[model samples]
Structures are given as structure tokens and as C-alpha cells.
Target: MIPDNEDRDDNKVYFFFTEKALEAESNGHAIYARVGRLCVNDVGGQRILVNKFSTFLKARLVCSVPGMNGIDTYFDELEDIFLLHTRDHKNPVIFGLFNTTSNIFRGHAICVYHMSSIRAAFNGPYAHKEGPEYHWSLYEGRVPYPRPGSCASKVNGGRYGTTKDYPDDAIRFARSHPLMYQPIKPAHKKPILVKTDGRYNLKQIAVDRVEAEDGQYDVLFIGTDNGIVLKVITIYNQETESMEEVILEELQIFKDPVPIISMEISSKRQQLYIGSASAVAQVRFHQCDMYGSACADCCLARDPYCAWDGISCSRYYPTGTHAKRRFRRQDVRHGNAAQQCFGQQFVGDALDKTEERLAYGIENNSTLLECTPRSLQAKVIWFVQKGRDGRKEEVKTDDRVVKMDLGLLLLRVRKMDAGTYFCQTVEHGFVHTVRKITLEVVDEERVEEMFHKDYEEDGPHKMPCPVQSSIPHGAKPWYKEFLQLIGYSNFQRVEEYCEKVWCTDKKRKKLKMSPSKWKYANPQEKKLRPKAEHYRLPRHTLDS
Candidate 1:
């Protein structure tokens, strides 16, 4: 909310957007952006003004790009807004992000508006209607006594001294001519940023005041439709005498290409909370490690979220044990050749020492094997190696097999279920084994005892961990068939029969019920043609 400073005693104002009431009759359901004001002292608006606001005024907001030769491009939907207050300015300026409603011109635009302009539009004029069920137009005749959408003040005392006493003519003007005639451009007199790529549109905008090495800068954190957040800043180029927009980084928050619906930044904590249709994710504003191993790369990035700590590119200034290490520019960029920084050593076999092996189920009982990934960007792969097979097979979720939020749940365990099961996370071409459980099918009593012992031995960090994987179960039928036909048995139906005997004589014997019904046809006895009587004419012709 920005206050109207021109009238020192006037109430502060807030801006929002909503669809027009008559939008159903328009070419498209155009949205109306509006600015509303409320008195600072009005709390609960009680007594004489019960259930009523004495000083409340709102007008439509028109934030469109100026067109060539009076033909303007209107962005119907207001996506997001920010009110930036500076030390030099009395009132905060409004920065709004907008998008078009039509699918044909799918694009996004950024518009900046001044608080004074909005106040003037509200105080200027009211709209008039020539006939019923008609559109509203600016009144041509003399304006009314007290202006419409004007708040009550001691300077201009009127009836009740509030917007409530404003006549229908004034109220209609506020409603009709709420839009400003001129479009507020960015620093370059154009949109600050316009993205025409159809793949991902901008959704949320968050600005943080950053104190970089050079000076203070307002960094824009823009969330997009592809679950990615972009760090951008506007730099004033003195030589060119123009404003240039620079993108610092493109950060991926979600593995799946889901749109980011909401974003909030905490400068104090240096963390960003992102909300999507299915889940909410927290991302550290600066992941210096992801910037790669070069010192030049790290410093040249000029990311307010990250800093070069001499020894390494880090989220924070390297201190404590890291302070004494000799600094190098290409440490991280050279793959951390010394293996000193984070992620340099993969925690693989070290985890196996603490792994748990337990008997979990009876001949026909359900059991769960837990595995969770360290990073959401990684994909989880489950591996099962039954006893004596000496071969590992990729596990797939199916009827008797189900995958829980963090782990695989085997509905019914057979004798062959005894095996070493593994869950590994694949990220950035690196595989790290997250969990390993050697499963064994045993009696009910042993199963219970083993599970109890396993739970007791597990440390605090291993219980009820958050599931970090979202593997898709349903794929194309032909794709699944192709995977199965090529003996590419990685993700296939792991039935007891299919695993033990699929193409052997044992399978045929199982299909043939009793010994009496079992008949073996010799290869010589098998006839290639139809019955000899039906093929007699063809046989006679061949013989002749």
C-alpha cells in the first residue's frame, strides 16, 4: 500500500485486480485492475459507520503498453505487483507484471506505474451513461461540486466528508474512468522484460534489496511456469546511457516441469519458498556449488546469492576450518580436483556399513522397503537382487507391487523375495546409493522380531524421512511392451512365474493340469499343411 502524499492527511491506498462485471459481454473476459484506499484510523469502521467504510474509494486501473499510432496492446490479466519504496521518493512506485488473455498473442510484460498517477486518475472525473444497459463514458458537462472517489479531509469539508456522500455521477466516474490515459513505461520507456516463449510464462515476482560489491541493487527473483526461478537485475549503463537487464542465473527448483504458482523470499534467511500445483519447495537463494568449479566463473556471475570464499564458491563466506585453506580460482571449476568442497565425495559405500538387513514378511504378507533421495532434482531407481540369482533387476510398481511416497511396498512376499534391495538417486550423471535393505521372508514370529530389532537399531535420522521422489508409474503401453520384449527387463512385471520360470518346460508343465491330459507332439509327427484330405488336390498337382 502507498499513501497519497499530495494531501498529507489523506488515507493510504492499496491496488488489486478483478474481472469486470460486464466481462461476459466483451470479446474476452477482460480483467479490471483497481486501486482502493482506506483511512489509517479506520479500524472495524464501527458506530455510525457500522458495516461501512467512511473513506473508501476504488477506480479501474489501465496498465497497457502504448500502441503505435494509437493502437495499443492491452495485457488483460494482472499477474503480480510490487510496491518499491525508496529513500528519495515520498510515495512508493508500483511495479506490475501482466499477461494477455488471448492464446494467439501468448506473452508476458512488465509495467511500472507511479502512485501519483493513480491518485490523479481517481480525483479527475466521473463517467456518464446515455441510456440504460449501456457503456460508461467520461462526462462532457460541468463536473459535480465535490469530486468523486475523494476521501474525507478537514481541508475540503463536505456532506459527511467521505466517499459515501459522493453522488451517483461521481461514483460512476470513478468506476468508468478509473483507468489512466497514459501508459507508464520502464526505465527504457518500454517493458522492462517481455518473454514471448510459449513454453514457460512468468508467474510471480519478488524483489530483494541486495548490497553487492559495487553498490546496492534491487534484484528481481522471477518465478516461471517451468518450476524455475530466475535471478535478474537492471543495470544502468552510463556509457550507453541506457538501462540493461541482466540474468544472473536460471535455477531449477523442481525436477518435473510443473508451473510455479507462488514465491516468497526471506532476505534475512536467504531462502526462497516456492509453491506449485502439487507441492511446496524451499530453495537456497545461493547455491554456489552449482555455478561450477571456476573462480572466474563464480566471481563473474555477480550473484548476490553466492560469494567466492577464496577457497571455494560458497553460499556464505568460508570460515572456521575453511578459513585456513589456500585459495584458488579454478578449485570448483576444475571439478574440485582436490576433492575438498561439498559433493566432492559421493557418500555411497560408507552408507552400506550402516545398512539394515531384516526379515519383513511371511509367505504372503506385505512389507515396505524405505529409500529417500537427498535432492529433489534426482531420480530414484530401485534394484532387487533375489537369492542365488547373482543378478540385479530393476523393480517396477505393479498389482502386487506398490510404491509409497518414499519407498517400495511389496504386497505379498514369496520365497524368492529374499534378496538385497537397493535404492539409488541419479542426479547430474552421478549415482549415489541412498538406502539398501537385505530382505528375507521368514515365519511370522521371526518377521516381527526382526522388524522390531531393526527399528530399535535405526538412529534418529533414519525415521519417517520426507519422500523426495515422484516417479511416474503410467507410461505408454507400447513403450512398456518394447521394454519387456527386448529382455530390457529393467522395468517389467516381476511376477513369481515370470521371475522363476517364463519360457522353460516347467512353465508348460504348470499350464498342463494333470498327467493324463499331458500330450507331447513329436516334431516329425506335426503336420505343416491342413488335413491330407483337404490338401489332396494340391498334393496330386505337385506329384504330376
Candidate 2:
């Protein structure tokens, strides 16, 4: 139940759902997303209608995209609805998640409605029809004394306090006319979010009202049937004079394409609860550490929950005392990193030092370089500085090279590809470097030299391999000799390479290694496994 009833005659309880259209045959509209309202303090009607609601009113909820030829693509099926209550009990924000089942035009949309508009719709005219052959139109009949849906408030004449003593004409009018004429349109007169991709439809939604530096912004966490949740916000563009929808984050809650069936938000913990048939997940509002330890990355992310607190990207806690709040910087609307992140000065080498990612490629073999921006709206650009000339050049695409969502793909890497690759992204006129990749292409000669080096005389250079060989009579394995030169960091990779090239079925190598600690796993089995599950998650945990 909503409505505090400050200026109105009654408090109301709102309803949102989808049902078969009344004029389905005439208009060819199969279904309609609807919003209904009923008086909360309702008394049973008189003799003709006893123990029934006397003030039920329903209105059409339209969500559509304007198409050509004066026709619109309508999202008629409502999948989910979220009512966000504010301080005003009467006016709450209504978020409707809608989808269409049209075979040719598969789509999903998000529509927002306000309580005032809904109340106006209920207070407007009613849809009436005289006969089966007649079209439905606004009724021009006489209204009752106290109105059909009015409650017995103190201001509206306190004569008859009960339904039994009320006028029969008002009861009859309320029973017959339940449908309103004026359809309740969305706040923007269109859908705030529309997805026509045939892959998945939006299943559920939860919203959090955030009070930013400018004003309160509604952040939407919309769950999809494909196991992904999209964090979105709407902003009004002053330049274009239109409302723009911005996607703040996209988190996959499940590895498989499991539809999200239920969701709830925790106000005290700042957590979102997601549920599927097989798994459940507790997602945080902000993953500040993933945005990189830089002022530019934190600011460019534009996450309302995150801010640069002069040292690191962290959850922006708006303190009431106001002393600690001045140092935090966050720009959710513009994402103007250069302007907003002026506290940290980028000198010269520190920018590249912050994002150090080294990649190795083999000669005449394929290699992939990954670089992903925090925001999906940003444009990724790859640049390379050659090792010999040290001149920067843009990485142009061709048949051998292609840009994908993950990163850049090099079909056949050559020795000349050895350089320093930079991954930069531009979003909202703010150019920020995502990462710096140091590419080192190793050929057959380098590989042979690395693995075939002679064992040093000193003990300081060895990787201290603890592999206990059962074959005591055989020659010492090449890995121990190579381990003396290669260091501990690259031992496992080199070991795998040497084992693949040297071992066979007849002489399948077996080395008793140190047992690793694992949870819910056997130490004997974990010793032979690739790696131990050092930090095992809950068995029912879903994907991030």
C-alpha cells in the first residue's frame, strides 16, 4: 500500500502486471502491460456488490519505440516491476521491465513511471462501450455525489462513513467502470532501455537511489536471462536535449546461461543478492580494486559507488561529518578524468609503471594481447613502440590481425613484433591508458639457448627444484639443469614445455613432488593435480 494521503481523498495500493487486452479483436493488440490502483481503506459495497472492492481502477502502461509509417514497436509483456519508495509515501518510482514475444521483432525494454502520472490516469475518464459492436470511448455519464473511488476522508463530507449507507449509484458506477481511458505513459514518453538482440530478455530488476555530488541518481541493476546483470543509470543530456542511458557495469552472475529468478538489495551491506535455479550470488556494489590503482582509472570508471580517495580507488562513503569527504573525487556524469583527477600528477615513467603487463609470443606462431576497458562505451586503441627505432605507431588491422572484445589477435607473430604495446581507451573526451604490454617474441634459437644453458657453478642461480626422481640410475633430467638458469618464476612454464617435447609413453616421466594444502580435496590427489585449490569458494557459489 502507498500514498500518505496529504491532499487526496484516499490512500492507494498500486498493481503492475500484464493481461489479455479487452479490445483484442478490434485493435489486434493481444496483451497489454497495465498499472492498477485501488483504495487501501476500502469497505465492501452495498447489497448488489458485497465483500468486493469498490474502487478498483486500471490503466494501460505503454512502452514502445517509434517506428516508421506512424507505427510503434510495442513491448506488451511485463516481465518484472520494481517500486522504489521514497520519503513521500504517495509518489514512488516505478520501474517496469518489459519484453515482446513477437517472432520477427524480439526485444526488451525498461520503462519508468511516476506515481503522480499514475494517479492522474486513475482520476481521468473511464473507457466505456455500449454494445459488442460499438468501439470503446470515454464515458459522458453523470458522476455520483462523492465520486465512485473516493474514500471517507474528513475533508470530503463525513456524512456516510460506511459502504452500506453510501449511494447505490456510486457503487454501481464503480462496479461497471474499472478501466480508465488515459493511458499512463513513461516519464520520458519512451523506453529508457531497449534491447533488440535476439539472444536474451531482461528477467528481473532492482534499483538503488544514490545521492551523488550533483543530485540523486537512480541506479538500475537489471538481470538478464543470459545470466548477466547490467548496472545502468539515466542522465539528461543538455547538449542534445534528450535523456541518455548509460551502462555503468556488466557483471556475469553465473557461468552458464541461467536465468535470474529473484533479486534483493541490502541497504546496510551495499550488496545485491542474485538467485538462479542452480546457484546464488552476493555481488558488491563497487569493485574498486579492479579499476586499477590510478586516479584516472577510478575517475574514468564513473561508478557512483567508487571514488579516488587520494590514495586508491575505493568505495565512496559520503561521510556526514564532512571533514573526510572533501578529499574524495568522483565524476559520475562526465567522467572527466583529467579535470577530476588533478590531485595526482603524472610525471613521466610512473604512468607506464603503474600498468605493467608483459606478454610473450613465439615466432611464426599466433599470440593474443588482451586489454579491456572498464567502461564498455570506451573505444580501445592499440599502439606499438618498436624496440629498434622506439617510434610509436598505431596497430592497423588486416587479415592476420583483428580486434576483438577480449583484445587484439596476432595470427602469426614474427620476431619484428617485439616492442612495447600500449592499450589506450577514450571515453567522454578523456584519453586514458588501460595498460602497457611489453611484447617479447622468442624464436627457436632463443628457446634452445634458454633451455640448453649449461648448469652454473654457483648455487645462488638455481631454482631449487624439489622433484624426487624414482629412476636413480638414469641421467639427471634436463629440467634440473634448465632450472639452474631459468629462475623460479618461469620454472613451471619451462617444465611443461620440456615435458611435452621430451617425454613419451614408454618413458612417461613421474616425479614425487611436495603435497599442496587444499580444502575439501585430498592431499595425495592434489600433489598430482595442476594446482591446489588454496582458497576454495563455497560449493554453490556462482560466477562474478
Candidate 3:
């Protein structure tokens, strides 16, 4: 049942039903499918109707497959109906799944119908009994003016009112011609999907609109008798005037493999509820984060629930507070997400700190200088900021000086190593300093006194005040020992240098020859004409 809120202001309900009438089938038993309308706004019962539906009207549901004889190819069993609200929200389309009643042509068919067409049929002339044994036929005579089965209370304020005013002939006519003559066909002129294996049949269906990277698409979730749910998508092709139906996935919603009785969808939450005789289960519509770890993989999957943030892949429709995600230009697609997300890139120098970190270390004490690269692809480049020629030179590594794989320089504190050191990252040929450190090695006598002071004192060791500067004496050591112990030293400094340099090497590399355009010396793979000697017709002997 669905309410026609758009047209009737929530006062009307359209119902699809299959019932065995007690009076009509009193002799034996016969079942028929029907569609009817009810005014939910009706409160006090009318005098004639008296608790009965005052505007009650029903019509037959016609579902059939054409046959040569046209004898008994009817499939009157209306298993389920789906009321799909389109984008307009005002108009709703009805889809019915029907199964055969005859034993010979045991099959299923899907049909579509419009609300307006059904209403028009109700307004037309009704069917009437022409002979005994409930023989019903269309009334060829005049429709009796103002017609029977009209919902109006009275005809021009006459004495009779409501359905009670309707004459017996008109009421009986309406009861017989309840069904419309014309029936609607599916969009593809056939059943969207069918099952004839004789083991199971379609039981219920639900439709959901998915907002993908491309656009919105309607997906169908169909339930079957074998405790399975099949998800399908219908793609329309304008040029061929056809629709392509694809089965996206299938899931088993029940543990005991019981038939699925009912199914419903929560569009806003992206959840589908499947019900069986014993239990009910809820399943999420999409698991996008599982597409893959790489950005290209996530983008190429084209899932509606996945998006690639600059650093990692994230779920666009996560549950709870994270569900309301706003779309950005960098959402995953078949395009370059990394390039599209460069707006968040650092423009100025990545290293902004000018004040150098001062450290006091003994001759034999070990220390580590950290330079963490901001990007995974960036290469950390270390160099001595000062030398005899006052020019920057690449730092060399040996047993005394170790370069850790994590972009940290381990040094055995020495007098020669006491100078300003630089750490820069070279990513895509863009060079920027990560940080600068000044290693001021203290004399051995002062270091020994500091150690003695630590062992002998009950309180924290108080180092001699730092060389007269703006820095506090309490921070003289500057976390050098703690920084070396932990590998997160690269993240210690947050700075960016406001400078730029021409990346000639990067430009040259970009303009260099492409491997696809490479040429080889051998050309035997190409189609070659006959050798000059062979094509010469035996050295011109034939011509001579």
C-alpha cells in the first residue's frame, strides 16, 4: 500500500491485493488479484455505506503471456508490488511481479502500470451481469447519466445522497467492470528479469537511487524464495532504444535458507532490511572502503560510496555522524586525483624555521638529527650547511656517521662535526629544507662535570646557562637525547622556507624522450618488400 500524498494530500491510499471473496466463492474456492483506493481522511461513516467503504471500488489485475490458443496462459498471481517514487517525487510508478496459475505454462512475468491510467479506468462505464451464474460483460447501453460508482454525495442536491443514492443497476454494473481493459507494459516491452528453474520465484522487490561519481542511477534489490537477495541495475541506451539489466551482486540474508517474505530499503541510511519467517537482517548497501588501498584502484571502481582524500581513501557514506559527507572536486574518479588535490600543497618554502636548535653533547655521546619527509615519494637530502669554502656539500655516511633509512643522521659527537646541518626534501624536483640544526659540542671537562652533577644530585641536573641568548637555560639540552630515542624526530619541527629555485633537472626529465617513442636498430618485424636482387628479375636477363 502507498499513499498518494502528492495528488491527494495524504488522504488517499492505493492498495494491491489478492483475496478469495466469501460470497462470490461460496460454492467452492477461487482467488483473484485486485487494486483499490481508499480515502483515509474519512472519519464518520456514511449512512448508506455504514462502516463499509463509501467510495469502495476494485479492479482486476491482468497479467498474462500471449499464446496461440489463448485458452489458459494467464498468470493472475500478483506476488508483490513496488511503488517507486521518481525524481519528481509527485509521480510514482507501480511494478508488479506475477506468477502463473496454470500447471502447463508455469512461469513468472513482471508488469508496469501508471496511476493515472488506473484512475481513468475507474471513471469509465462499469461491467454488468448479462446472464445467470454471475456472467459479467461490459454494459453497451448508456452509462445512466452521472454514472454509478461516483464518489459525489448527491446529484445536484437531490434527496438521495452518497453511494446510497446509487441505483441497484448502477451498483451491480460497477462491481462487474471493476477491471480496466488496457494494461501497461514494462519499459523494455518484456519482464525486466525472469526465473523459470522451477525451484524458486521472485517474491519481493525494493528500489534505491544511488548517487555515483557519474550521476544518479536506480538499483533494484529483488528477493527470492531461496533466501537470497539479488541486486541489479538497469542501464538505458537511447541510440538502441533498449535497456541493459546487470546483476551487480547476490547475498544470502538468512541463516537457515528460508524464503525471504518481505524486504524494505532505508535510502538515507543505505541499509536494506530482509525479513523471513523466523528472523530479520539488515545489510549495508555498499562497502566502498574495501575497494582497494591505492587511489587508482578506488577511483577506477567508480563506487558511489568511496572517495579518495589527499592522504588516504575514505568512505563517503559512512554510518552515524560521518554519514553526511560533502562532495569535493577530489572525489575518486578515472582522473588524476593527486593533481586535482594540489590546491592543498604548500607553496612557500616547506621549512620556515630560522632559529637553529642548539645542543650540548660529550665527545663520545651519540646524537641523531631528524629530517622527516612530508610526502611518501619525497627523498630526504642531507648536507653540511657550512664548509671551508662556505659552500653547501652533501653529507657522507660511514661507521662514525650513519644515515638511517628513516631520514635521520646519527653522529658520534665530534669536534669536526660541530657545525650547522641542513635537511631538505626533493620531491618531483621541488627542493625545500625540512629543518636546520646547529651542533655545538661542549668541552669534555664541562660534560664530565654535568654527568657528575646528575649522579650526585637528588634533583634534576642543572646545566650551565646556555650561551647568552633569548633561549631559556632550562631547555639547554633541547631534547636531543629524547629525539634520538624516538623515530618521530622528523615530525618535531613545523616550518616552511619562503623561497624558490628553478628545478632545471625536473623540467629536463619531463621533456626527455618517452620510452613509447624509442626506436630500435632491427626492423625485421615490419613488412618488407622483396630484396633488391630478387626483385631485379634475374639481373635484367628476362628483359634482355
Candidate 4:
């Protein structure tokens, strides 16, 4: 019966028969028995006398080893000696003796079967000296008793021999002989030893072997006899000549010690649950505080993928986006506006929820200017005007400029003071950004006339004079017509004409004549003009 919480608090004992006992009973076998006397309600419940001197039977019997008589007599007095069968009754029985005599114990055995006809009868100590003695009866088959000191002795051998005068030579000869004892090959491998109580206190329990997970005992959580849980881990260092095992972390969980009765591990969740008589507590293996020795932070000082986020060091995805996610503040500038970007809205009386006021300045009716002079003493105010036609204008003023220093006053001044102001980092003196403000004074009336007037020849006014040239036919009508006569219509051609005309004194002397003088000159003289030479044909070319 499982005890209730109240019953447990009241210190009541609970007894439960396991499922294995029920299965054994269903098979018509006495598999469960209390050693010595069975307990009744208050005292010895019932005493069943077992005849210790029975012959071989095919089932196990439980009894206690008497302090005076020893092991052999104790086995001999059983009502039916059960020899377990193996290999289709072809193999010998295997016996396991559990000695609960005291704290120290040893137990295991192996045997082989022979034909019943060849087995020797037990004639006590005299049988070994005289050879086979008692006749073999069909009902009582002769079985050879293994020679003393032949098999490994679980206990001291002095208790076995009958007489003080008995020759010690036989026992000593048997001990020295190799053929006297047969080694018993264990059926299953030994279990792995896991230290669940965090520390290496397993030696106190005398547990020689324990099973490990897939032969890799990497992690060990030890629960102490007192409920303190210590976690120990074994790490293999390939760098060493012999890989060394080291314990990484040790933590004490309970303030006071209690006996840890059972330990269960959940690999899926990386959790360890320790069951104690008093309470059950769980320890998560990978929780920040319970990090193991092999943890990246504990072993490698700088984990590229992990960072300390104020409170704890945690692993994070190695992405630039994730880094941006953790940033506290971001400042963004748009045209002539600046704004502060926050991950979330701030809540509380300390923070203002209203939209932040922004200030701006306009120059030459064209350029827009803004500045963020982060300071506690000065506050800047901006005024903006928009006409009904949708044109915009702005002006800015600093309120607390009582007695500004030269540098501060110069910065506060408008476009006259504004060249391209570069943002210079205070620490490095590096130029970061260039802010340009250009200014020009404009005549408002002239600007309005220029924009509103139409000069497409549709107006009433005519040009002041006829738009034709006044120069005579042979004279240059401005420099452009002279250039056209010289085949210099394009800028490049004009440059070539100038180069050729200026190179000779004759051409220079002819160009020096005034327009009126060149026009009055004879056709022959006019043909002598440098520019006129390009249009006049040569005498030989006329004949051709």
C-alpha cells in the first residue's frame, strides 16, 4: 500500500508487493519470501520449518547462514536443494549467494554437470583419502563434491575442514593446482558508475562497476546519501598524451542533507530529478546557473555566439539583425528633420508621450536647415509660414543666448556665418558630415515682375530699332558675319580663322581698316581683305 501524505507525516510504514512478485506467484512458484522469520502485525507472524537436509530439487530456497555451523551445513539442511537448469538440462546450475551477514559481503558461483552414475557419494573427509566409498543407490545418485579450495573461496577456508590433525597438504595442493578451480564467466556486463551527488564520493559505497550510456559516461549527477546533489562531468582532452578526465562543476542543492533514495535522468529535457525520502527536486542541466564544465562560457572565455545581456550571459543567433534588435537607441535624419527611433514606446510619468517638437530654418527662400544642439541650457524655437499658394518659409531662434561665447555665437549666426559646416568628432577630430547653407538677398518686386510678366512678342511694345545690321556690304556686320565669310561658322572654325589672319602683317593691316573705309575701298582692294580672300577665287581657278 502506498502511504498518503498525512500517513507519511504521521510516520506510518508502507509495504508494497512489486509486480515481479505477482508474476512469480502466477507461475506456481514461491519467488518472494522474507528471510528468517516473517513479520506479523506486531511480532513474528508465522514460522515455517524448512528441512535443511534434503536432496537435490529444481527450485531455489532462502535461509540464513547460522553463526556457528557455517555455509556447507546451511546448504545441506535445506528441505529440497534446488539446482537450476540451463541448456536443455545439459548444463550445470549457477548459484548466487547473497550474504547479508553484515555490511561486508561476497557472492557468486558456477558449476558443471556430469553423468549421475559417475558422481561420487559424500563420505565426509575420509572419502578423499580412500577414493570412491559408499555404493551408489538409484534413489540416491552419487555426485562429486568439488575439492576444497578448488573454486574461488568467498570466505576464509579454515571453517571447512573437520579435524585439526587433517592433512593441510590436500587443501594447499588444491589451491596451487590450476585445474582445481574453473573460472565463472559472468552472463552480463557490469553496470556503470554514475556519481549523481555532484561529487566523487562513490568510493564510500564500494560499487566497483556501473553501466554508462553507450560507453560514454560524459555526465554524472551524484545524489548524496544526504540529499545534496552534486553534478560532475568528465571531459576528454585530446591534446594530452593520455586523455584526462576532469570534473567540471560541483553544486550543492539542499541547505540541509537528506538521503537521496532514487535518481532519474531525462535526456530529452536535459533535466535530472532526484527522489529523496523527504522530497523530490529537479535540476535542469543546462539552466544558466547550473552550467556544466563543458559549457562554452565556462570553458571558452569568449563565445562568439553568446553575449551578456545585463543580467545573464545567453546564446544568440549570430546575425547582424539580432544585434540591431538589442541596440538601445537609433537616431535618424531626414532632409532637414531629425527623429529618435525607439524599439517601443516608453511608459511612465518620467517619459513624455507627446510628439517631440522639431525646429528648422530656411535661407534664400530655397535652402532648409536644421540642427540638433543637444544641450540642457539652450532651447531653439522655429516658426514656419506657408502662403495660400503652398510656398513654405521658416525661421529659427535660440531663447537662452544671454551672453554667448564667440564660438557659440558664431554657430548661432545665420547664412552669413554659414559656409559648409562639417561635423567634427570631438575625440578624433574626424569630419563626419557637411551641412551647407547658401544665402542670397533678393528684390521682392523684381522677382514678382520676372515671374508674372510675358515677353513672348505678344505684347504691344516693338524693339527700339530695326533688328538688321547697319554695316555696308563689303564691311563686317559685327565680328560674326566676318567670321562666316572666312568659313568660321563654328567656334573651332573661328579659332582657326583668328590663328591664320593674325599670323601675317598684311592680313592684320587690312583688318585694321574701319567698316566705313573698307566699304568705300575698290573691289580689288576689298578682295585684298583677309576674310574676303576666302570667298574670292584665284585667277588660275577662273580659267579652269
TM-score of each: 0.48, 0.78, 0.48, 0.21
Task: Give me candidate 3's TM-score against the actual structure.
Answer: 0.48
Q: Supply the TM-score for candidate 4.
A: 0.21
**Residue pairs that clash (backbone atoms under 3 angstroms), model 1:** 126-173, 127-173, 293-332, 293-333, 294-333
Judge candidate 3 at residue 178 and give its lDDT: 52
36 Cα displacement, candidate 2 (Å): 1.5
lDDT of model 4 at residue 364?
Answer: 31
Residue 384, candidate 3: Cα error in Å is 58
Query: Candidates ranked by TM-score, best first?
Result: 2, 1, 3, 4
> Which whole-number lDDT from 0 to 100 does residue 274 have in model 4?
62
Best by TM-score: 2
Kindly list the per-residue Cα lDDT of model 2 for residues 211-295, writing each as its tens digit. Answer: 7765668889989888878888888775875777777767777779889998999867889999999888888876776666777
Of candidates 3 and 2, the better by lDDT: 2
lDDT of 1 by residue, 389-456 (tens): 68889987789888665578888777777788888755444455666777656555544564565457
lDDT of 1 at 441: 63
Of 1 and 2, the candidate ranking higher by lDDT: 2
Tell me the alpha-carbon RMSD of every candidate.
21.4, 7.8, 24.7, 38.6
> What is candidate 4's lDDT per residue for 1-544, written digit by digit as tens?
1111222221112121111122111333223211111111111001211221111111112333224545331111111111333344433332222212222332211111221211111111211111143221122223223332221122224332222212345333322221101111222211122112232222111001112211323344444555444433333334542222233223344445656666666654656666766766666553332221222221121212223332233432334465544632211011011112112232211112112211122223332232321111123332233324533332433442121211122223333422332211111111112122222223434444433442342243532222245535664322233333324334453443333333344544544745443221222333444431001100111100
Q: Candidate 3: RMSD over Cα atoms?
A: 24.7
Steric overlap count per candidate: 5, 0, 8, 21
lDDT by residue (32-114, candidate 3, tens digit) is 66787654543323343445554456676666544567543556688999887876554687778888766675677666677
Better of 1 and 2 by TM-score: 2
